[model samples]
Each structure stands twice: as structure tokens, then as C-alpha cells.
Target: MTNSNVFQNLSQESMSLDQVFHNIVRYMKQDVIGNYRLIFGTDSQVHTDHTLFITGIVIHRERKGAWACIRKVKVPRKMTNLHERISYETTLTEEVVSLFSEEMKQQLIDIVLPHIYKGASFTIEGHIDIGSGSRNKTRVFVNEMVSRMESLGLEPKIKPDAVVASSYANRYTK
Candidate 1:
């Protein structure tokens, strides 16, 4: 959503975040045979000249695996703390989800959220890059990040459980 060339198609076709959302929704509407979950996440890698941040939105269909849309953004600044980096990652994921929600409001209300409200086993979650290993200092930010996601009305996911952010998106950040 930030007017930076932050997102691209798998074929390396560049497009704005709004275009990406519309594309995803078009796919979703065409492939509406099963239950699905919309997951958002972000990951970052620091290089010599800049830090790369990648955000992903994953559409998971029960018993059918998933597919994702990713966006990458680079910043010249560097981050030193686990909490700060993780927090920024959370913000990126949140922004992407916000735009998705805005674009898909009617569809979500009439289709997805209703299933969730009726006790369907579907969810919309935000994944954070923090892990639980003692060797991982990012664990310190897990509680705060989880609370933040909850406040945003999303279920939260952390490392191990957050492959969409920490793994899938991480591939492109580098």
C-alpha cells in the first residue's frame, strides 16, 4: 500500500498492492468450491545496502493446500533489535490485510465472515515472524504482537506456525 514498487507477480510483473488484491479476489471468486482462510504475514532480511521486507497474503483452502501473493519492499535503514524488526513486520502485514479487507468488504461479509460467524472452521490470521526458541530473541515480542493482532480482529500466528511469513515470504526477501 505504500507507493513503493513493493509487490510483483511470480513472473516478475510489477503491480500496485490494489491491483494485487483485485487479482486475488478475482481468483477467489472463480475458485469458490471449498472453505478457505486468508492469512497475512511479513518477513525482512537485512543486506549490505538495504533491508528487504516481504509481505504475503495466503489463501488456504481446507484439504487443498494454499497459494499466496507476495510484495517486497526495500529500505535503506537498518534495524538492530528483534522486537523492533518483528514489530515492523507486524505493521506491514496489518497494512496489507487492511487493504484486502477494504477491497473485499462486501464479499467477506456476505461469504467468508458469515461462515466464520456460523462456527465454520475457517479463520483470518496474521502471522508474525517471532519464534519460540530460547535462542531466538524474537520470542520476547510474541505476546505484544499477538495482542496487537487480536486487537486488529485477527487470529495471530508465530514462528513454526507462521510459515507464510517466516518461510514463504522470506524466500523473496533475500
Candidate 2:
């Protein structure tokens, strides 16, 4: 298994965590008076010999537009166990979120602190790829994963609500 700080999107590649932080700051600064959300999530695809995990980081300007990037991690062996795979995805998401230092977060928060009275706000969310649908196999793990997100002081999202993990990250996992 390998872990790296590099992240990339269609417009940029090989961005260090500091660059990613500045990119997020630049986007938020564009319209400080608007509402915004930061989301982090991860999805994985297991191949015959290894598993590829993609963690997506997105900063949404709430219905206007969003800036997103992803970091990939490759585990040197196939991971077919459902619980293990799901747990790893969540772990990856958490790992990426942890890279943002308290000061970095404060930088983003400070951008909106002044405009809060005008309805501007900022929120952070963690999207876990699991779901709670009774018929879904991942249902059993929903509570555990959501609790993990909550412990990080983030809003937890799953399945239908977790498009970042289930949708954005999943698309490039191949």
C-alpha cells in the first residue's frame, strides 16, 4: 500500500496538499458572500491483483459551481472482502480530510465569517459510500461509518446523499 499527498483534477495535476489548500481558498474567495460546502469521500475498485482507491475532494459554491480534485492510492493486493473494502474507503476519506490543518480550515472559515450575516455559511461533510437501505448489503455498516464521520465533527452522508463517494469517486476508480 502507498499513500501520497499528490492530488489532481482536469485542470491541474501533481498538486501538493498546500497547493490544494490554496486552490480551495482561491475558489472560496471568488464569492465569499455565497454559501459553500467542502466534501471528502473515497471509492475503490478491486482488480485481479490490486485494489485502486480514489479519494475525491470537492468545494461546492452551493448550486453555482464546484472545484474538485482527487488523490489515488493503490494497494498491492486484491481486496474482495466487502467489509474490508468499505472500511478502507472510509479510512482513505478520513486520511485525506486530516491533511487539512486547523489553520487551513480557519483560512476558509475566515473568508465567510464576515459575510455570515448576509446568509453566507460554510460546512464540511464526509461522504461514506455505504448505504442504509434495508435491501442493500452495506446497510449493516452504515451506523459504524456514520459514527466515524461524526467523531471528526463533520456532517455524514451516505448512499443516495453521498454522490461524492458513490458517484464522483466511483466513476474514476476504474
Candidate 3:
């Protein structure tokens, strides 16, 4: 979710997409020979006057360290429809994913190309804030969202595995 085309992390208040890309590159350079996971997710909260959405991007080095950032988007009115809210969250996450062009992805991959034999690898995942568990109201929508993400050529994670959406982004939606 981005209203101003900027994102922020713990250290910076405002950053353009290019800046975020560079930051990701800098972070990966710290350990170019490690496994990398690029994850994106979105969560939303409905308030009296507006609905706040937060999309989180997490660059995780597998069992190693990670870097995360969030983007906020505000809808002018409360969103009470469960399906609509969930659909919008998925859209927002997809938007962030679109920011990574093929060239950029290849650039990141090139960082680990030399050490591929030594376990260096890269993968991208889209974390939807829905689950397929019984008793979960959101379960009904999981397949649709997962299909949408899969169309974008990204692996999808849900619920317990969707830490970026369910845990990180959800925290800021409040």
C-alpha cells in the first residue's frame, strides 16, 4: 500500500522505490553467498473514518538476518466488506511486487551467481493474509488470491507461513 510512492523502514522516514531497491542490494551484498527470499504482503485495518493498509516487503536471508520495510495507504472510508478488503489487500501486495522489474531481479540474482554451488539462491514469495484452515472465515477466499499471485509467477504463502502479511504488515495496519 503506497499513497506517496515511498516506503519507510526503521532508519529512514521516506524512500523511493529505487532507494529501496538499492537498500536491498546493499543488504544482500553483506552476504552474497547466502539464500535469499523476497517476500511481499499486505494487511488492512478499518477505523471509524478510514481504512489503513500496510504492505510489507521483507528480504530474508533464509536462516540468517533480514531487512523489512512498509508502505501505508489510507482509504477515506471504513471498509466493512470482508471480501473486498481481502481482495484489495492482495492487489496492494501485487503492486509492490510489480516494482521489481525483470532487470532488477536479474541484478539481484547476479549477486549470487558466482556462489550458486555454495548454496546461494533467490526466490520471491507473495504472502496473502488469508488461510485455508477449517473455521477460518478467510479460508473461502484463499484459492482465488493464491491463483492471482501464481499468475504473477510468484510463490504464495498463507496464514502461518505468511509472516509478512499476518505478522509484520498486520502490526502497522493498526
- All models: lDDT? 0.75, 0.93, 0.93
Q: After superposition, how far is residue 19 of candidate 1 from its true place, in Å?
A: 2.8
Candidate 1: where are CA atoms >4 Å away?
1-6, 112-122
Model 2 misplaced regions, further than 4 Å: none
Provide the global lDDT of candidate 2 against the true structure.
Answer: 0.93
The residue pairs that clash in candidate 3, if any, are none
Where does candidate 3 have its weakest 10-residue lDDT segment?
A: 1-10
Which stretches of candidate 3 lie above 4 Å from their native place?
A: none
Q: How many backbone clashes does candidate 1 have?
A: 0
lDDT of 1 by residue, 5-116 (tens): 3567575467776676666566555545547678888999988866778988777777766757787777776666667778888888878877765446556445545455
What pairs collide in candidate 1? none
**Which has the better TM-score: candidate 1, or candidate 2?**
2
lDDT of 2 by residue, 40-59 (tens): 99999999899999999999
Worst ten in a row by lDDT for model 2 = 97-106
Ranking by TM-score: 2, 3, 1
Q: CA lDDT of 29 in candidate 1?
A: 59
